[model samples]
Target: MTRLPPVPWTARADLAELVAALGPGNLRWVGGAVRDTLLGQPVKDVDAATPLLPEEVQHRLAATGLRSVPTGIAHGTITAVLAEGPVEVTTLRRDVATDGRHATVAFATEWRDDAARRDFTINALYADPVTLEISDYFGGLADLADRRVRFIGDPAERIREDHLRILRYYRFQARFGAELDPAAEAACAELAPTLKGLSRERVAAELLNLLGLSDPASTVARMDKAGVLPIALPERTPDGISLLSQVIAWEQAHAIAPDPLRRLAALLPADVRLADGAAARLRLSTAQRKRLSKAAGRGGDDAMDARALAYRLGMAEALDQMALTGGDPAPIVGWTVPAFPLKGGAIIARGIQAGPDVARILRMAEDRWVAEGFPDAGRATQLLEASIADAKIA
Candidate 1:
């Protein structure tokens, strides 16, 4: 039997205090925190499973002078903000009905009853905040030690409960599981069609999370081979898949910048039709949408010329684009584009009338400025005058 690592005593004490304040037998540290603690991963969020309903949890949290948010009251979840951080407390629930995409659940009091309803074994592990003792209604501890991500019951049943799990299965495998259970793989294959019923935003969010995990190229390739990608992004090109492995490697080497737009831009295809509709459907931020547009429009020529490079993308974005494509972006120098030395006002001041000619002469001057290695305003003006004179003779 593999021995689990000891829980962080400091975190346990903190949670114990919160549980004491809420009263014993009312809450238990649950979900990812428990599972991650056993696996030795740094816990990011602390979650609690409570017998009390959402309203009760809210009232109790209020007494502690901590803010409470009804994040998912209908689903029996209340977010309590403590001095250290926010903890999500959800009441025990059992699924009354499900339609592959959403679940209608009824509140319950039994921990095992709640455990039975969850998606995976590893996710069902719970710990008593006061005693620090773990309660594994399912074989979550074993699965974690084994490095497997098995469904709680029948894999098909779990997938039917939430089709998003099809993508999540692969994501978990990429992150924690070293091998895929044959039955789980088969179930995902059978239910791959149900993924189409899910919202684009849901699918995009899951896909992005999966991408954020380890070796996204391999994970994406596995998803593609399993036929999950088609339901999520049907228009993705063959080249997209071919490029993904290289992109993943590049991203890994670069230590992953915090900008989601830059990361999303690297994954986007050169074809607008492939990226535009998906970006809109996912409701990506305006910056992300613009980055995708620029990435698609520029294609592999993103690093070709200084003007194209500086005008189309920032230095960091240029480096990301180069890294994504597995090229050296060092050629794209950091030279600032000398501000277009001749604005419309400047052109008008030079006796260029305020008509279409004003716009035209400015364009001509800008071209001369760029051609003259982007010199200062005075040199640019001299070059513009010489070009205008030569054009008149022609």
Candidate 2:
């Protein structure tokens, strides 16, 4: 019976209160919280597996005056908003049916049944909240100590149950399990092509998550060598391996910015062709699409001038572009570009008509102002008048 380390601030108080409220027989800390605790990693979310139904858990939480959200009521998940934070409480469940991506699960009363239905051994751990005692129905404690990510059942059967697990295995290997399991790797390689059956959005999200993981470049390189990345992101080329490695190192060193869009921008090459409507196909927001497009246009150069170009794009966009290009953007600090002092309306007041001529004159004036080291508003106005007069002569 292996023991896990003490829960960090993220889990300690919340789990203690929830356990006191729900009692031992009804609830236990489950999944990532337990796995991460054992691994000495900071737990991000606290999940509990319980014999009580979702509604019962909700009722219990409501009785405590804590706010509850039916986040996944149909799937037996209830989010209890504790003073510390929101804790996700889910009833023990067994998968009744699955089509690789989505599953139809039935709530269960037994812990073993719920643990058996999970994808990987490292993720199937559970712990008694009150006693802080650990439970390993599937030998997950040993696997966690060994840094292995074996499936709960047969590797092939697990992949068949959920193709997403194929990608998840790689991500887990990159994040938690450093040594690649031969059987697990072979299983993922064999089932890699089935990833094409997944929706672009789903595939994109999984890949983005992988990219955001630690040492993402190495993970991507591993995926590329295994021939899985092409099935997931067909836009990349063989030459992208170097670019991916560079970007991952840059991102790992500077953990301040960890957005997936920026990571994606870093992985992409300047000349790589995107599928028509690729951004929309991946369900990327308009701003994300625009940032990636700009990053792609700028290439991987992180020079001060390049950062200024990125600033013009938007600070968030610039940072993301810098990450995608695998370059340190810190040199782009204090980069201030002057804005046009006069508005189109102000220009129209100077006898400029509301036509292409007004736009043309303003652009010319702005360019001259920038060239002159960004003069004051008075000088900008004089430059605008001069440019307008010059345009009239031409």
Candidate 3:
């Protein structure tokens, strides 16, 4: 008899219209939308389930002038694009076959059967869109109330159904777990090796998502102890966990936002080669790979001021290195690295022949400018004259 309290998403007219188009009794709010709503947390994505087939759901949506996309039609999912945001409406389905990486599913009409095929109990709760009544086929209500993430039927069976659940178990545990469900933990540990079969993109996405959470250090340490971390990221050292904890502490103290890539950098050894290798294995974007590589080296003792470091390395990477090395970011907080004033053209205009000499003189002037702490354009001109004098004497 649990009821969902009034939430912001449920009041949207477009959602109501989609539900009405799908039919009154056939659809209900399900999955994370329901789970987060009941927990009083802000829900980002809204999802629903219906006994109606995907084609029927699409037709009904079109009839109501709502746009529907076959986002995952093979899995009985169709996305209803509303003005507020996209709500994924899926037909109820039961797994016909699972190979730990993917599943072959058959559409089902019974809600309980569909819910039974889900990975976690708390994620299987459904709420009637109109009456707000919750339908809990498993012990989802109690488990959710206890903030425990328990697999729906059997932990090993669920992990066998989808190997990615091994990582997902820890991620959900970090988000909502009060105590480790011993069974799920054991199953995840035993089946951790199966994660290698998943796509590198999927693995990277989940790992980054876990690190993106608020204070995932303790959960990551637990994952390390459970033998899951080595399989997911073999490059991690024992000290990296403690380092990650320190990084999180520094971020919190400085009121800096949590960054997954920066945290990942902290979890790695201070070696540029290893950072590049990890970035390659994770299939990270070019910019992300460069940032990770830049953050791999140790910081705070280079003797260059924060602005100098910021100028050499981009500002974001500088801040990340500073935080990872326990250096104060106060100096770089609002400071912008000023650009060098003198250019090669100005050196050529100074009666220096436009050849290697101009390039050489420009280099010397720029170096002096940087060394002198990036003085004003006027001082830069004086430095240029000094460089010209030095070059003539040489």
Tens-digit lDDT string for candidate 1 (1-394): 3333565643555565568667878988878877787877888888889889888888877787668889989899988766678788899999899998878899999999999998889899887765667788778887888899999999998999999999889888888897678889889988899998888878878877876665666767777788877677775666676666666666566554444344455556776666776689777767667667766665466435545455446765565566555765445544554466566787667665677776666677776676556777789879778756654521
> For each candidate, what is the lDDT?
0.74, 0.75, 0.89
> TM-score of each candidate?
0.82, 0.87, 0.93
Model 1: residues >4 Å from true position, as ranges? 1-17, 253-269, 281-286, 300-303, 306-308, 315-320, 330-394
Give the C-alpha lDDT of model 1.
0.74
Instruction: Report the C-alpha lDDT of model 3 over 1-394, residue by residue, as the tens digit.
Output: 8999988888888888988898879899999999999999999998999999999999999998999999999888999999999999999999999999888899999999999998889999999999999999999999999999999988998999999999999999999999779999999989988988999889999999999999999999988998989888887877999999999999899888889999999888889999889989989999999999888876634787777778778788888888888888887888888888778889777666678898888888887887888889999999899989999833
Model 2, position 369: C-alpha lDDT score: 73
Q: How far is candidate 1 from the true structure (C-alpha RMSD, Å)?
A: 4.0
TM-score of model 1 relative to the true fold? 0.82
Q: Candidate 1 vs candidate 2: which has greater TM-score?
A: 2
Candidates ranked, most accurate by TM-score first? 3, 2, 1
Return the lDDT, model 2, position 112. Answer: 94
Query: For candidate 3, what is the total of clashing residue pairs?
Result: 0
Query: Which residue runs does candidate 3 get wrong by more than 4 Å?
Result: 336-343, 351-394
Q: Best lDDT goes to which candidate? A: 3
